[model samples]
Target: MTDSDVTISMFERIGGSATIDRLVDRFYDRMDTLPEAKMIRAMHADDLGLIRDVLKRYLTEWTGGPRLYTPEKGHPRLRQRHFGFAIGDAERDAWLLCMRGAMEETVTDGAARQDLNKAISGLADWMRNRT
Candidate 1:
């Protein structure tokens, strides 16, 4: 099979919206409880409900599932949106730690899990604003 024919979207591999929701929920759960994630977690409001909804939408779109995010929020402009935060190596690593844990718990396919980790790690690295 050609690359186009063989390759499935990360969303499909991740079992679509329901699984994505579970992953996002678990990610925040880890962030809430993990001491390593405290700095990143402090960046959010006490209630994770709203952020979880936003993440579900964003991840859905990001993983090539649907366009739920932009219709409501316009451009993601992720870096601009995150400019207020000081995301150094520590914060990025902590964020990745929670995400890696979430993906491990939610995603079953090995290749899909690895691909997701690479993509997420790249994004997290990009989100870093400090030296």
Candidate 2:
């Protein structure tokens, strides 16, 4: 089948697990170092190891890759899980800042990066729990 006839998943388009690993690592690195991300960074645990693993699995499944997170974590219930944190517009912006930087660093496909950015931007917006 021609490329036009093929349905490519975001996972494959973005170069799969390797890219995902790099993306998540870069994302957390930004969160850990970027001054702009301080507010959201404060919401995370001091140790990022566990959350790093969780995010990798979640992003893998969310991007239409193999099922890794759901089987272990059940439904993402992302908003519910994050309810303990105070996610506002500023928080979302900080998150997007880190994520966008990570995407730029790891997701090589331009179109895939843009699409993932849009989808993730929406998720970040929806996560806001404050004004």
Candidate 3:
């Protein structure tokens, strides 16, 4: 089957907003504490609350639940937003490491986990702003 055919909406696979919140929380938690995440973690503000909310809303719309982020923030423009940061291979890998841990803790379905991992990996790679 094609990837789209096998793909489930991130909302359904992740159990909606509550689960997304948990996932984001766990992701930030790891970023805050993990030694490997130090470089990427330093890029974020001391207060992660707003960032968490933004991510939660963005993921909600991305997964087909609601368009909350777009309505408030306009287009995602993910790459553009990340351009101000010095995202290289190390930073990208650190972000992915945190996200992978979060996904492992939040998603139980093997297929869903793989799908999310693939998408996240691609996004992380795309976020790399430096050579």
Q: State TM-scores per candidate.
A: 0.95, 0.96, 0.92
Q: How well does candidate 3 match the true structure, expressed as C-alpha RMSD?
A: 3.3
Best by TM-score: 2
Residue 50 lDDT (model 1): 100
Q: Global CA lDDT of candidate 2, please?
A: 0.96
Q: How high is the CA lDDT of each candidate model?
A: 0.96, 0.96, 0.90
Q: Which residue pairs clash in candidate 2?
A: none
Tens digits of per-residue lDDT for model 2, 1-131: 78899899999999999999999999999999999999988888999999999999999999999999999999999999999999888899999999999999999889999999999999999998889
lDDT of 1 by residue, 1-131 (tens): 67778878899998999989999999999999999999999999999999999999999999999999999999999999999999999999999999999999999989999999999999999999999
Query: Which lDDT tens digits does candidate 3 get at residues 13-87?
Result: 878888888889999999999999999899999999999999999988887777889999999999999899999
- The list of candidate 1 runs beyond 4 A from truth reads 1-6
The runs of at least 3 residues in candidate 3 whose Cα sits more than 4 Å from the true structure, single-residue gaps closed, are 1-8
Error of 2 at 16 (Å): 0.2
Q: Sorted by TM-score, highest first, which candidate order results?
A: 2, 1, 3
